[model samples]
Target: MADPLSVSANVAGLIGLANEVGKIPVNYASNVKSAHEDAHCLQKELTALCHVLEQMRSLLREEKLQGTRFEETAALVSVLGFTNHQVNELYKKLDKLSIQANKNKLADFWERIRWPLKKDECDKAMEEMRRLAQYFQFSLTAANRLDFLSQTK
Candidate 1:
């Protein structure tokens, strides 16, 4: 069985990364004109993902799964761990496109004017994120209805 506290920590980390990625679209929007619609779509996806994560975090806290050792708990933890990895990778990919505030004004201006992600890449990322968010939400709902402690015995 997975430790609930540790799983909660993973959820927290993913939430933070999601928030960081969400901010990128907004920041980039100020400088990039061509990607306005894409940025808005990405932002909405991130916001939805973040909302799901926050709900999961609250579920973890309210349920206090520490004393229960069950198969379902393990499965939930697995999903969380995998989602954490995916979100981290997405953050890295998006972060690379971010312009640093300390960079040369001209360089910053140019970087901001250009959106680095190709259309396919943006679509793929958004699709994957949407899928993961829905999966996590399903897992959370299942977790709430199941009795893990009895199953372990």
Candidate 2:
């Protein structure tokens, strides 16, 4: 990668974007403006992901820092890569669900859901939440591991 620090920064940005995207009521995007906005945000997140991929490719190009020797880095990159893919998939699903949602029903349900923990009623929303949680899980694991690994060096 460009550097471990750069990769970590990009991943942190990705996580923040994913967190925001997860909270958006994509399924309730009943208008062109909302969907368009969500799409724009997603595009920005994808651009960040692309930057991370480029950094990884740069790392691979380094003959002195051959990828095989950096086992922990490789593992972290792999997990982060998967998390990135999952984030994209979740975004697409959310947008599609939002477009297909009954906004009136969703609005009423969301209002009530806010008062209660009845998130299961909205399958798509639940899925987004689940993926968001997974992202956090991965981020924490990597953060802890990175900290420990860096300290040893």
Candidate 3:
């Protein structure tokens, strides 16, 4: 098995890519291009890392040796924390975004609504906006729903 710190370090690197993506100026053509390329690269790397993590998790689950301490495993799990509440909130947000995306997909919606928009440009803008809105809504809904559940309990 790989050192716990190595797994943590890789996770940190993946997070760093997310931070960098947040900082990129999406309004500028060149910046958008750069951000897209960076995002694609990060996605590839993170997917590979996810496979590695899954394998490690499976190994940990399969091992049933007597007297095998679980403190390290517990600590590792803590480091990779995302509670059930958080996941539930995320799902809600995704649902909302999916609705918004459907709305944006209507033909001539942007032209009839927003100003100074070509059909192609409007479609592109709406597509990107819908994607981002859904992503954010998912995160927000997940967090809020989890919070609500906790409060109720």
Candidate 4:
């Protein structure tokens, strides 16, 4: 497993890249092409960084680390201009979905729903919301809910 410090450093690097990408000028004359290219590259790097963060988070969970890195990652992402309100809202929706998905009584209701249609509906509802949902899923699955709740500070 990678060192936790190294993982944190990588996440910080990605956050820096995202900041750089945000600073690219939209109307620069001579440097427009290069700026666009750099922005694209940074976007790719950010995506990869998100994946790495997920892996590191999983490792942290498996090791039973008393401290969590999810909130730290979320804070970094939020600091990068991802709105906290949006993240919280998405999490609420996901909590509802998880409840709906796991409910025994809802099993019959889910079954009675049309297959692709229901899926498409759910997908549409979840569109632009998967990132937060996935983040929450990772955090919840890796650690106990009480542990996670206690770390909210």
- Taking the tens digit of each residue's C-alpha lDDT, what string does model 4 give over 1-153? 344454455545544443333233222212333333333332343344345445544544455553534344454345323523433342343233223344576674443231222345334433433454465346545556566778996
lDDT of 1 by residue, 1-153 (tens): 545566667788889988998998887786566665777788789889999999887776665566655354476777777777877777776775675765488876666667667788889888988998898888777875685755877
Q: Which ten residues in a row have the lowest lDDT in candidate 1?
A: 64-73
- Distance from true location, Cα of 136 in model 1, Å: 1.0
Rank by lDDT (best first): 1, 2, 4, 3
What TM-score against the true fold does each predicted structure earn? Answer: 0.80, 0.38, 0.31, 0.27
Better of 2 and 4 by TM-score: 2
- What are the runs in model 4 whose C-alpha is more than 4 Å off? 25-153
**Which lDDT tens digits does candidate 3 get at residues 31-128?**
23333343333334334434444444343344232234445356444434432223233233222312333345664333222223234643443354
Return the clash pairs for model 2, or none: 1-59, 27-98
How badly does each model clash, as a count of residue pairs?
0, 2, 6, 0
Best by lDDT: 1
lDDT of 2 by residue, 1-153 (tens): 344554555566565656555444432343333343443444444444444444444443445333333344565666666666766666654544333336597775544323222234244444544554455455556656875798999
User: What is the C-alpha local distance difference test score of candidate 2?
Assistant: 0.50
Pick by lDDT: 2 or 3, better one: 2
Clashing pairs in 4: none
Residue 110 of model 1 has an lDDT of 68
Cα RMSD, model 1: 4.0
Which predicted model would earn the best TM-score?
1
